[model samples]
Target: MTLFWAGAYALTRVAVDKGNPDMGLPVAWVLPGRLTIGAAVLWVLMLARGQKLPPLRDRKRWVAIIGMGLAGSVFPFFLITTAQETVNSSLAA
Candidate 1:
């Protein structure tokens, strides 16, 4: 998780450096795209390694997953990238 967050921060800083003031990427790729790709890669790795994923069958687990996705996934995805748009990665850290 730490590594993932660090990579997200790095990606956001780099993407921001290449994007516009509006945080728009006129090109084919963007920060969110990169983050999605990273997630996909990690998911694939976990699957290949036969790692057990979160059980979303339970109501409580579902809620936890939703909360985690919103808090740990989506929130950081936007915040880190947007922050990187204006601040240096080291300073943001």
Candidate 2:
């Protein structure tokens, strides 16, 4: 898991580096693309394993879901990807 995350940061740095020829991906494109793909893949796996989502009508559940989504995944991803733009991936990771 540590290596995987490290590699992810390295790849992110490469992708987000605008000066790299034919390899540079826009910073704007990185976060959304990564998050969406990650989310889709996780959903597919969860469905395959027959894991059901929690009840949507539960207010407490929704709050926790939204909080985790923003704080746990989205915020961290955004910070790291953004950081890679101006800093080395190894340091950013």
Candidate 3:
């Protein structure tokens, strides 16, 4: 976990560095791509584990799930990667 986080911080730092225009990925592209791939992998794993989402009709539970996902998962990563654009990896992480 430590290594992965370190790498993520380091890599996003490089990726979002606009000073190196030729080598850097666009900031707009990185977050969504990372999130989409992560979501895909998680979906596969959940299926493999025989897990299922709460029914769509369970509106409160569904809302809670979405809210927690946005707050806990997506928001933090978004903030970290965006911050990485302006600061050193260690500082951003």
Q: Estimate each model's TM-score.
A: 0.62, 0.82, 0.82
In order, how many clashes per candidate?
A: 0, 0, 0
Query: Candidate 1: which stretches are off by over 4 Å?
Result: 1-8, 18-31, 52-57
Task: Give model 3's TM-score versus the native structure.
Answer: 0.82
Q: Cα lDDT for residue 66, model 2?
A: 90
Model 2 over residues 17-75: C-alpha lDDT tens digits?
Answer: 83563567776798889888889999999999999888888889899989999999888
Could you give me the TM-score of model 1 versus the true structure? 0.62
**In angstroms, how far off is 22's CA in candidate 1?**
7.3
* Evaluation by TM-score, superior candidate among 1 and 3: 3
State how far residue 32 of model 2 sits from its true place (Å): 1.1
* Over 4 Å off, model 2: 18-23
lDDT of residue 63 for candidate 2: 95
Candidate 3 lDDT, 1-93, residue by residue in tens: 789758877878877884565677776788888878879999999999999988899999989988998998788988887777667888886
Model 3 scores a C-alpha lDDT of: 0.82
Ranking by lDDT: 2, 3, 1
